[model samples]
Target chain A: MSTLENGTRRSPAIHAPGEREITFGEAIREAIAEEMARDQRIFLIGEDVAAAGSVFKVLVGLLDEFGPERVIDSPISEAGIAGIGVGAAITGMRPIVDIMFGDFTTLVMDQLINQAAKTHYMSGGKLTVPMVLRTTLGASRRSAAQHSQSLHALFSHIPGLKVAMPATPYDAKGLMKSAIRDDNPVVIFEDKMLYQEKGPVPEEEYTLPLGQADVKRSGEDITIVATSSMVYVALEAAEKLDSIGISAELIDPRTTNPLDTGALIQSAQKTSRALVLDEGYSQYGVTGEIASVIADGAFYYLDAPVKRIGAMNVPVPFSPAMEDLTIPNADFVVETAKSLCG
Target chain B: MSETNDTNPSITDLDAEHWLQAYEQMVMIRTFEETANDLYTSARMPGITHLYIGEEAIAVGICEALRQDDYITSTHRGHGHCLAKGAALDKMFAELLGKEAGYCRGKGGSMHIADQETGNLGANGIVGGSAGIATGAGMSIKLRGTDQVSVCFFGDGALGQGLLYESMNMAQLWKLPVIYVCENNQYGEYTHNSKAAAGSMVGRATGFGVHAQAIDGQDIRTVHATARLVIDRARKGGGPAFLVCNTYRFRGHHVGDIDRPYRTREEEAEWAKRDPLTLLEDWLLKSKQAEEHVLERIKQEVKTAVDDAVAFAEEASFPSESEVDQHVYA
Candidate 1:
């Protein structure tokens, strides 16, 4: 084994290329570590990012590898941290500001919407805010109300911001590097439940461009578009549908803003039917956004109405059964896909 | 402790040229704001404008202490700060008129004018919005190992914002080089400062362990001297400092806010007696800094500059409809 720049152990070069299975949290940590080692200007600032290594432990081992200066732990100030990220990015620094929970974005509406999103445009392109705001979303572990939410649709509505939601470890590592190197502001929403989910990630460095959608499964009957944690549920639903007679195609929109509408529209046209699944509220959520995109682009080719499945409108409850019913699971997707295929 | 002595001795120690420049900058700001008022009255300018007429000393003095590369964040009433930091008069007028030659290409009006080359980050419409930005700029300076200092210019209304305390705590904790200048103009829009704020402005900064001071904002010399000391300390790695300027606004909050419902005529008249311009003029003549004719010539030069800017703005065209969607992203 060889040591990485920050003293992390890595496997030596081999004649044949191979993939290593790692958790999504490990992939995110690797991306941040690699980027910081490459550029001294890149730093992490957030609540409990240092000693606690973040609430989800996604940032574990980063504080030790890089000193305190690079791994900064901020006070409980979301607005201040967001504004500071914008300010530092404009001046000369690539800051990855971590907002502990996605629902807390309400506290930083002015900083993110008014300041970061509009600074580049308001400056007439004179200033660029090259920053990444990382936050966690989704509900499953019984964390109710303020702790659980999937609010990517709110961020996608705002211009001048790029939204990324990586479902797998491969996409998590690749998309994060792209976000850090991006010239404009990007918001990365990580699913809380997917942190421990294992997936194959390459040993070599790689990056996935923003606005690109990945087609996880191919089918001729129907298309299912999902985001974040729902992407994994859609793939699992596809497996169940294949055992039956129905074949379902799965599309994961890794980046919500600057969306790959072309890929989505093509899939919808080929399948002639589409079902959008989201963990956010059904009304005015990512489901509606995807349904509209397909309606506008592939309306002629569509053989059936585009259906959508999203979380219940009510707030996530504390009980396990209620919370499970609130968030869409593989069973829900399977039922919805069977209806669409029929 | 002699009452007969000069309230601030450092005011008399400045060179003749320094006094003249400060006096001219204050005059220029007055002329620019008065012209903007005239344009608004005649319906020649678009959108509402917040005049920095009486609080010119705060912007000029704090900016004078900063170098060309030092960073500054401004509030909605930011024209004075932009001018003091070396923004072009014609471009500022063009921006107010929503013309194509404006600093933000007619996209950002008077409230959002910014000159990055001069280190003047764009003015914000939200109160206390720039506090965190200034703190982050200080963090950037520390990370880059630069001796540059950042100044955040906000009003007393912003004192209640959580961002101010949050940013101050971080800046103090990291020992970042920043100066927080609160231009207390006695009003937050229509409400008086006393009715809206509690405790003391100095107490807020001191609570964060930052060095805080309050000075006479009407006296440009005093403002200049105090700003010089605080800005010097910050640049020398002394962390953040807060300076509160006791000032007032002569006009209403915005151009259309004519009726003085929040304040009385007599109260306005009393503050008008300590007009920053008249106070600076009295000091200049009493200190023998310049003759009457010299001051008059400087006034003429400023008037001509303002007139030229207005004419240029009148002649400049509005941005084309095709470019409306441009500059939304980098």
Candidate 2:
């Protein structure tokens, strides 16, 4: 019911009272700054985290505040940076390593998965690597095949590492804080398209738990579980469904690794029709995992088979029109939801 | 071997106690590897192990120069480095046997042994995996403003890995206190270093602006002297340095490798003449730093220790099935 001076209907308010509005990018910067201020042991190491403030500018002004020692600028070596993160984390330091792109995770997979993820477990609990690998995900920015990728599913499939995907500015700040404090390694996948999107985030210190899910809209006809940038698309689809007299509930799973299957099952039980969506490929992705969870937990209560909407199984193209066709949008979600409801 | 008695200050400055201890450490490593080979041949051990037979001096000499608190990253052929860095023989044996009392509680076999209390970060299965970790540890030391230095032990096979150059560049650019020790043990798995490694080993380090030195890895005295100066310089914040220890692996790459078709027996015999343990024993006796009785006593001590470790490993229990899911997260 809240509206701005232009009389346009604002997005549904999700935060508690007295929260201030901020962009997803600003929320990330504030979280890093505040966490760095609180813990001297926490430091940032990556390619352009220092003087450049990162390619996305999500780490703007941190270099001057934390100095060169804490905010380190590494060479263009993902493996080296990730290795340093694991080493520093185990040796009494919390390191937040930034991989400039999610696609580049392939270059550092050995250090990230083989070394960082397995060190604590392989060491029989003698060592703990409290590190955060922050990278950007999602496409449609014309980044082509190399730069743009929503590879959260790959990380979530691994057992030893935690995966967090924050869809809103509020969740962005909160989840980042929790990730820094966690004793295990966490990979945070931020959608590049949502960096400029504005949402309410508290100015005071707060942290959201990594594995919890949030219900963006309470409805009864269908339950739509979405992640990262897809959360907003799902919300828009819900509005369109409301005009057609079909209620669609939206659930945002902040972290994919420790998935909130209980909340997802409860929502599916209420609606009896489930639609799982993601920006990643359809096969062996976040949508498939959610669909499996729903089938296992809410099969008897469901009125229809659980539906999934995902990006087409192909590399993201460079052209905007072609890329848009490959990626799922609000219209695609609405069409999928209507079919599931019928 | 004769050069050990030369008037070089680095070798001459070492006293009788240092020489005796260094000789004993090398003996322990050789005995341990021989026992490991026996265990594998007799089907007592389960997994594959890369024997560090001929490269004992590099581990013993470099570790002798380090303090108890300084850090060191190791590679797959890590048993010698583990022993030299003060890991207990029994626990390492227990680890090889995949017992609950092992360093990793039966999860990690020979390739992943680590003792944090002794400053030995876990050995990596990947060829050049530990370089970044050593560099990061150096960064941590610099940030903490500590005098501690970190050493990274790798093989000639890792020379072509980009992670090494990446880490070395960062270490030099930031003046991180790290010592990169490359044990150039001839063959990388199956290929010779000449075919696999391009240019020169020293050139790889010097190109990164790191002070590099190629030393005789078979000579424990030289290894000890060079490691002492380089480790001390790094601790003093003089920046990172690289040491290319030109060594040879007396055994195959792994337990099952026949080691034929690539290297000839004549080449193996040629390198065997420079066996580190023999060189050290010759130096100890010729220099009159240790008597025959003293040398025999050290051998007896090492054999007893290794025998006790085998017995302990035989008696230790395997982990329960219920605990398989533990330690995946902190």
Candidate 3:
């Protein structure tokens, strides 16, 4: 599906679909609430989903309107929330289960993979688990390990689940609606840091279909593809690269499972140099997939070994300084892009 | 035999129709597995499957307690669960054959079997995987204002997993409409229950504030009664319950490959003596619920069904080569 705004051309707009301004959290909340209202089959369940309305209040006011049943609250049981969502989805319900933080998702990998991911295929396409798992993955707020992580890479690695990492509110709202409507299992990842961040989005119902990649910025110097929270850092780096007379193409392969390798292959063919950035450890992450896509799809076009910039290989340290050292920042992306360009 | 009503009869509240239905479900599970086991050993099947040979009662007992549309999340040893929840036998066999007509085009094999229409959420390969799914199913029903309950059938080994605890906490905290059925058949693969599990099953569930029970899994009737009590309450918003069905695997961990020397022959014999199928048949005849000729006919019906299932699977074609990527995404 075409992005609501003009492709790669940002213009100030008042009532645009993807550019109409709204806070990221508000956009996400609206997506969830609107879907629940539109389809009687859709409902949400997660920790603090009710009166407390989610730890971040992203699900705020949901319980008041839908009551305990629809806007249900639950124990801090990430695995159960995910498992329940899978069950409900397979049983003719569309559930948006919430995992308060991304780190907790490890507790529910079985349900997400062996259950949600495989059900449709295993049942010979006789079953479809149409479910959404919504949670935050960001490290800037210093939540530390066990609370903070951008593990979109892990979910994207799974074959049956569709992984969505929206860099802005417009993408978040649209992508989430698409996730809700998708019959296969989908993982919708939101960077906690981006929740309060504002960007334009349409006020009415809309869906940004999954499996399509969005070329955020087009340039000729180098192509830099980043995911989730790293999209922000990549944009920042792109801005810095512009000052240095290097134009970098920034591509956010918003949906990772059905990855937009075609886009990466095309961009690599043009730029002839590439740097992939992500918030996960560099080893065996989404960046690896991007690298392979380029290597396999456009091998001869690269001017430099395709560079991958990502969070350092280590548990996210609790200290802010250590955390800063662990996660890839805009400066790190900028430096990597410059080196690759040289 | 003077058995108390509370002595764990599997189907306590239902009339003759429901009782017969439960019996039929159990037969479907037993017949499907036994015949499939024979075929599997002879190299007639393609993908390797974990047979639900000795545990028909647990699935039958628990599923009987659920409504037609109530959801169930099954474990890797899930053939019986799928059968009991109304998965067509022919389709299941086709899946085993990895045919185009198979459930997942033989891509998922036996570890993952699902039927959305009948509300059989899926059978998961990962231990304790169904807990979260069942909990989420409960949440969905609660959200829709319907009283449908969700059942999660996990092995006792699953109790040791962290996900089980996580699910228990959520289900209990919100009083979600879910039932956590721990089919404790004494072993987790080759490991003994004592070696693998840390705390009491009921104790773990109770700590999470869920009403919990320990029941006799060998007695299908007993399982039925206890499960009904918990399942009924969930449908009416009484919240979730945990039932640890203390059962035993009369066979080896998997199919006919009885290679594990973990449990002694004496233990096998002891459990064999409690075969649910035999007990139900005896009761059906002695209580005049069914006649001997009728029981024989029922066996024939199950056998014919299995025979047709094998025929259907054998005739089904393998999925076209391009199907590998067909169902990868929604």
Cα-based lDDT at residue B73, candidate 3: 83
lDDT of 3 by residue, B1-330 (tens): 111123444346676666677777888888888777787789898656676766787888887777778888887898898888878889889887776676566776777777766677777878877777787677778766888888889888887788788877877777888888888888888778888877666788889789988887767788888878888898889999988887777666777557668878887887888888888878777878878787777778988988998899999888788877776655
Q: For residues A1-342, could you state the per-residue lDDT of candidate 1 as single tens digits?
A: 122336332222121346677878999999999999999989999999999999988998999999898899999999998888988998989999999999998888889999999998887778889999999889887888888888888999999999999988888999999999998999999998888766678888899999999887788999999888887678778878889988888888899898999999999999999999888899898899999999999999987899999988888899997888888888888887787777
Which has the higher lDDT value, candidate number 1 or candidate number 3?
1
Greater-TM-score candidate between 1 and 3: 1
Q: Which ten-residue region of model 2 chain A has the weakest summed lDDT?
A: A1-10
What TM-score should be assigned to candidate 1? Answer: 0.96
Off by over 4 Å in 2: A1-18, B1-12
Candidate 2's residue-wise lDDT over B1-330, tens digit each?
011122223653679998888888889999998999899999999988989999999999999999988999999999999989999999999999999999999898899998899998889999999999999899889888999999999999998899999999989999999999999898899889878887878888899899988888898888888888889899999999998888999989997886567889998999999999989888888988888899999999999999999999989999998879999999
Q: TM-score for all predictions?
A: 0.96, 0.97, 0.87
User: Candidates' lDDT values, in order?
Assistant: 0.88, 0.89, 0.79
Poorest 10 consecutive residues by lDDT, candidate 3 chain B: B1-10
The deviation in Å at residue B214 for candidate 3 is: 3.4
The reply for model 3, stretches above 4 Å from the true place, is: A1-20, A143-148, A318-322, A329-335, B1-28, B62-66, B198-200, B206-209, B227-229, B288-291
A1-342 per-residue lDDT for model 2 (tens digits) = 222336432334475677678888999999999999999999999999899999998888999999998998888989989988988887889999999999998888888889989998888889899999999899989989988888889999998899999988888999999999999999999999888777788777899998999998899999999898888788888888999999998988889989999999999999999999999999999899999999999999999999989889999899997988888899989998899887
- As for model 3, its CA RMSD to the true structure in angstroms is 4.6
Q: Candidate 1, B141: how far from true, in Å? A: 0.6
